[model samples]
Target: MADKRLAIVHVAYGAVGQRQNRRSLSFYFEPRSFNSHTHGRDSANKEPWTTRYGAQQDLGYTGPLSFSHFPYTRCLEDPSQLFDIAIIGFPFDTTTSYRPGARFGPFAIRSGSRRQHARGYTLTWGTSPYDLGAGLHDCGDVPLSAYDNAKAIDQMEAAYTTLLSRPVLGGTNEAYKSQTAAISLDGKEHPRIVTLGGDHTIVIHFDAHLDTWPPSGTTGQERITHGTFFAVAAEENLMTNTSIHAGIRCKMAGIQDVEHDDAVGFQVISTDDIDDYGINNIVKKIRQRIGNSPVYLSLDIDVVDPALAPATGTPETGGWTTREVKRIIRGLSGLNFVGADIVEVAPAYDSADVTGIAAADIVHDFLTMLQLAEPPVPHKGPFSLEDLKYP
Candidate 1:
């Protein structure tokens, strides 16, 4: 005896008659025929969405799915939608020493961002980032060559560079387009980049190791890793020595590593300094050291105490709380922050998605800072420190 069950799924976009803020997709399933195969497979007692790719037989379900489903536009579909700032996911965690689950950081961060759509408006900054006139997009994650570390780093660098080359003003603030268009970096204009990290190794770390030095006597593959990406960034002139590192609590490779980091052009502030100087002084120090230079802020989740951010690769104890970090981040407004990243969130280790939620909000702060920053006026003469300060 042959027995089968048929299921029909209906997918609809927008509402019954409205189209303006169509954010939800409705799905209705109806079962009918009992003898036909769903998609070349038996239809008896098996889930229809079970195939090589884990996708259901094509019944066609295209609604709306994006970072937050608010102002959704892809880079390929409309490059003009990407401007001022763009979110790029670097889902590579191959160089992690203690934990390996940070590769899932991007997915967790995006998933956690679902809670942010309702309040994209920032009360602290007194503005909605979406309404600020800067072009924004969820350009999606960068596809990395999984096995090759060097190639993966190259891919990240190239992908970032490509996005940087795009024009920065085209959204509602088209009136200011001519003004901001004149904004240049080292004689070239570039869009700012906000990266969702895979691990602490990808940028800066919070634990007792600095991944800035080249592995001694290395060849092709050994030359690059997540920890070494910043070294490569220096080689490529992606950033300058005026860069700064915060929430440093880990031990270093050696005293020379300190010299190496100094040579690399970074001034680091340890977590203990917060106990001595407090957050306000820390903010002032960062602003003083990084004066006027374009900035790229890389925040490792481990920078927070393990109690607050346990889902990281190598967590050090006695770190700052989420509130403290957020305050510091907010205090960083008005700096020439061209790019930033929040990395090393391993959702598997999280208790109730706390780490992921914290990361998403951190990224939200980054966007807010970009919006609050004073738009660059056309440089009439040589750029000076006063030019970087914002109202």
Candidate 2:
């Protein structure tokens, strides 16, 4: 009986060994058929995987960084890549008076815009900026020297001048093209620039303080801090006399600062004026002040109350709320805006990224403002029963 059991066990072991040997041989040398359809090689396939290598639709969390995830282009270096509107970054903060972190403002603003997409729609504007026919692209940041304020300022001015000189793409929509015609000071069709700033100094002087401080007698680097760049801009003829400032609440050295600000070609609208005159009135005043001239808008993040947007080089307590500022900006839609910048966003001081997010949303408004042929129609809320006439 023992001998018969041993023979059966040997036979079972031999059968298992034979099956294992066959499996190992098949693993190395099995003949397999390739499915052309699965590999994207089928001639009948209408859409091929190879053709979708550079799709613009991107998930917010992933992908290379750019404002609102617009296609990145070296438009400044290569003018052939045409664009009607370009977003550029100026990352220099050596000249700031109080805080020095605004050099990182552009990056912070871009990072905060991660959740925004070009195709995203805004209820307030009733349209998506990308839906408007405009060739918008991110021109990336202008290279600047960190150690030299004078050189940095020169670089910024040169970059702005170059971008302002570029011809518009005149997108497929004829109405938008016509609306943008002759918007430049030269009475020519020119691309609009939305600048992400290094400091408040680089704008048309929107902030809690009057940036048009009289140039100190001393020349060189001492001459061009963030507080005095508008004075430099005025000297360079970069700003028009029709320019204006809003949200002014800074402590001043008597009324001479106001006199100097006026001489620098900026009409002042104090922070308190918003409380007294209201948002619509402020927008009306700005629109009337700017008229049809090519307007360059410079907004300092400190324009908002410090409690709301504290990540700025200069913070004043009594300032406009982010909503108030956005409302005022939305109201200024029909104005001819050639260039604009939101500056002084130092994210190091930010809490939960409120300031960066505010700056990003403001840029979103900038895009909508640039692309709109006319001002957006205000929404009539559902609660407005006047529209519903009882039968």
Candidate 3:
């Protein structure tokens, strides 16, 4: 039954929706197949996603599920049924003040990731992504049209609501319930989720899903935030359980109304904290706040110090560096990372794919981290930074 289930997974692999299907040049995520998206279709030993961590491989023995098969948007199919991770695109950039191409981010990321997603890599967590057998899905975009800001927000809210509902494909077997529903019903597990972004605002939508996390009243936890996203999520009541962002920036003046409860616990990783303790100390502080919660990490490319990733719509100057990010993520292996997304990678800004490549490598790092085993072994020091050595 398990083998049959696994085999059918390939055929069942599909995207959930289409973000930019237009004219005759439209592109939608479907079950992977040979196509132009693959930069090295003919290579005999093509390995999809890779970084210094190791080569990319799914938990099972199937070959890499290319970008062709990635970010599945066809709702009729289910990528989550097979792979555990997804490389999402959030092309919405309205809320951002800096760049507009972020609205076109999903497309650019797809273009850059074509070959990588198709191939995938293995991680140094001493495990294969395939061995754990993760699933993949391209949920298309958040459907923002004509720029009716309120309407766009509504659609975004609806999209994430559906995602968290744990929609089920056509099946009524004993485990037929959607993965999330199954977890809620039978005490089984649901797939973890990692969303890409149209902008940092997309994190607000996920609030409805993760806000009630840690089964409520669990224990200590921090809150997550960055300038605009911080305020928006705070209002939405989402950052609470995540135990992210230790400080609420002064720039976020009026926005704190988003999710402000007196007992909201967890401090925002404040500017003062960073000023006093430095990023390294802040990183450890974040981990301590969360203790052990299945995390859904969302990296707005802006988090990478402006010096590193300037192409983003919101480039905060004093953000963490690539070196700092490597240190933090390396320390974050064991926590149950449900899913992740690297939002706001606008390629139209700077030099040759600098931000795009950076974003790609970050996503690669995320996947490798996910490839770690169940009871996670402790991470001693920085991971083999070699995986990210390339562009």
On lDDT, the leading prediction is 2
Question: Which of the two, 1 or 2, has more lDDT?
Answer: 2
lDDT per residue for candidate 1 within 1-391, as digits (tens), equals 3433323243665465544222111111222342243443344334443653475322212224344444555463455565666787888888765678887888888777775655687555566666778777778788877787778877876887678777664666543343234445355445677788754311222333355665442245455555665676667676566666788777665688778777766777888899899988988888787666555577888788989878888778888898888778777776655578888888889988889888888888777776565422222557788989995
What TM-score would every model get versus the actual structure? 0.71, 0.80, 0.57
Model 1 alpha-carbon miss at residue 345, Å: 1.7
| lDDT of candidate 3 over 203-305, digit per residue (tens) | 2111111121221222222222222444445456655544564223323323343244223443455445656887668667766766655456666676666
Q: How would the candidate models be sorted by lDDT, starting from the highest?
A: 2, 1, 3
Q: In candidate 2, what are the lDDT values of residues 59-127, reduced to their tens digit?
A: 776788898888898766886866888899988888777877987889889988888784568778898
Clashes of each: 3, 0, 65
Better of 2 and 3 by lDDT: 2
RMSD of each: 12.2, 10.0, 15.8
Model 3 poorest 10 in a row by lDDT: 201-210
Candidate 1 has a TM-score of: 0.71
Give all candidates' CA lDDT scores.
Answer: 0.66, 0.78, 0.49
Predict model 3's lDDT versus the native: 0.49
